[model samples]
Target: MRVALKYICEDVDRHGNVRCYVRAPGKRKVRIRALPGTPEFMEEYQAAIATAAEAPLRQADEAKRGSFRHLCIRYYSSAIYKALDGSTRNWLRRALDEIAQEHGAKQVATMQARHVRRLRDAKAEMPAAANQRLKALRALFSWAIEAEETKVNPTIGVKKLRYQSNGHHTWTNEEIQQFCERHTLGTKARLAFDLLRYTTGRREDAPRLGRQHMRDGRVRFRQAKNEHRNPIDIDIPLHPALGESIAAAKVGANLTFLLTEFGKPFTANGFGNKFKDWCRQAGLPHCSAHGVRKATSTALAEAGATPHEIGAITGHTSLKEIERYTKAARRGELASQGMSKLIGKTTA
Candidate 1:
């Protein structure tokens, strides 16, 4: 059923609880808890609509001065939120907005550690989602505390959920070979695969890469995610595999090697969706864009590239990320050396 405006829709699941939310502008759809017909819900819809002009200024200057909603609005306007990349900012806004709508009237100074933990526990099944929500909340509280809007940050000691599972399955050499064999050179699939595997850039930055970044056979770009905080200029020499794939594909005047069906440059999300289709077509549903990045790091580590070398190419700020690969490579190297010495003794 239609809820309030053209922007909102009401959803009733199999169990029959209703949820009303904004349905348009794609990414900005927010599910506000109040029902469509209620006076309170109408007021909220109006407030959300009204905030289009000046969201934070309205909150700070309005009557609900010390409320949690006001604090969130203020935080959104704060430099902390502004510094985040597009995707991160979107996620943070959604998380903070939900909290604001729920506990908007509550005073930020009164929030305790218990409140933070309870918020975390609500998304118990998905550790990542739970952590993301908690992270956004922490940023908000931390910003508030710094501004002296609140005396204590509620999320100070609340720990992230401990879970076991390899996050994204890192593709092995065999899997990469299989994918390549299935999707031969001269195809978009191969080009996309080679672009990510060869460049070792995150999926977010993949769509932004093109011929312009190339200089003396190296691809260079500032990483989109954490560019400001951990700024590093990435310049990776073209991998032979990627060079061969690109040569075969004969990519034309398009800005990036990957493009949509319409031949337009892809948005970051568009490229990911297109790549997933390529993987499924190759019967390598288990493989992914990010997995290709892992494979690149693994190859470098196995080939004896230092953490600093890996960081230079991948724009990684911390040694911790490449430590696993380096450690494994060291063990393999030692084992090979020891086995060779043993073989020499037996032969002698």
Candidate 2:
């Protein structure tokens, strides 16, 4: 039989089996195969060749080109959607969308280290901002690699920019006393600070503490930042200032202890801003809500609390973070001890 060469691609297996792929006219795809050393096999193969004779010539096209924007969308929609929480997912989506808009439509496969470096350089002035941007990019690229969108992640070797961290601005004893004197009770801002200093919880978790959380002479609530459900049992007892402040605040049957000026739940950001205002009014240094947590940890360590004990209260999973806080606290304690020794020598 005369076999037309126009339509199929052929390959012979190592075991002498001949395999034929059909490329017939008007067919988008085709498959054909034949047994080894058989006349019938050759006959069928020739028939397939003849059937594909009038088919259009096929040329290999580049893999379906995908842009950075396209791959990012796929990454976010697929893996990131399921993996991240609502707040984090929303932040990543917004940040990446903005980045894509700025960088134009470039193929993901073609994105180079240089492009990422340029973006990193532009954000170098703001380390925290740059770090967040890098994190989002890293997550996107990681997703892209998992989805087979790219073979290499340009963000692999990139390092996050570092900036000086203004350590926790915990209020001094005098500062705390002064702040309490200037601020009146019954206000959300005042109650918020008192509770924060007393409980040592994250800003988000502070407002969630209600009368229900207080039991058996201890404040207990799950940490929000880490979803750690362990209760913080403070044995030192709540200070009179905090106890009186909570008692003076209006508590509705359905409402929690802390509420906004309008009686709604207090958001972390809103409470932080108000706390800063209170600090300014009391002539104190600007301190974040997190500072309260640090201060509490410091105070606990200075009072001879063990690392394990401090971890229980702070919800620290590892001793490393707890150690850092305790180390600072210990340093302060040593300073006090040194002063006491000097005073004793003079008296003697």
Best-matching candidate per lDDT? 1
TM-score top scorer: 1
Which consecutive 10 residues in model 1 have the weakest lDDT in total? 53-62
**How far off is model 1, as Cα RMSD?**
12.0
Backbone clash count, each prediction separately: 0, 0
Scored by CA lDDT, what does every candidate get? 0.76, 0.67
Model 2 scores a TM of 0.69
- lDDT value for model 1: 0.76
lDDT of 2 by residue, 291-324 (tens): 8778777788878899998887677778997888
Q: Give per-model TM-scores.
A: 0.77, 0.69
What is the per-residue lDDT of model 1 for residues 1-348, given as tens digits with 9 covering 90 to 100? 432375766788899988877655524656667545433354456445534433343434345877878777778778877676656776888887777667778887788899989988999899998998999988887788888877888898899998886777788888888888988889888888888888888787777677777768878887767775666788778777777888898887555666668655566666788788888887888777898888889889988899999888877778998887788768978898899989857753
* Total clashes in model 1, counting residue pairs 3 or more apart in sequence or in different chains: 0
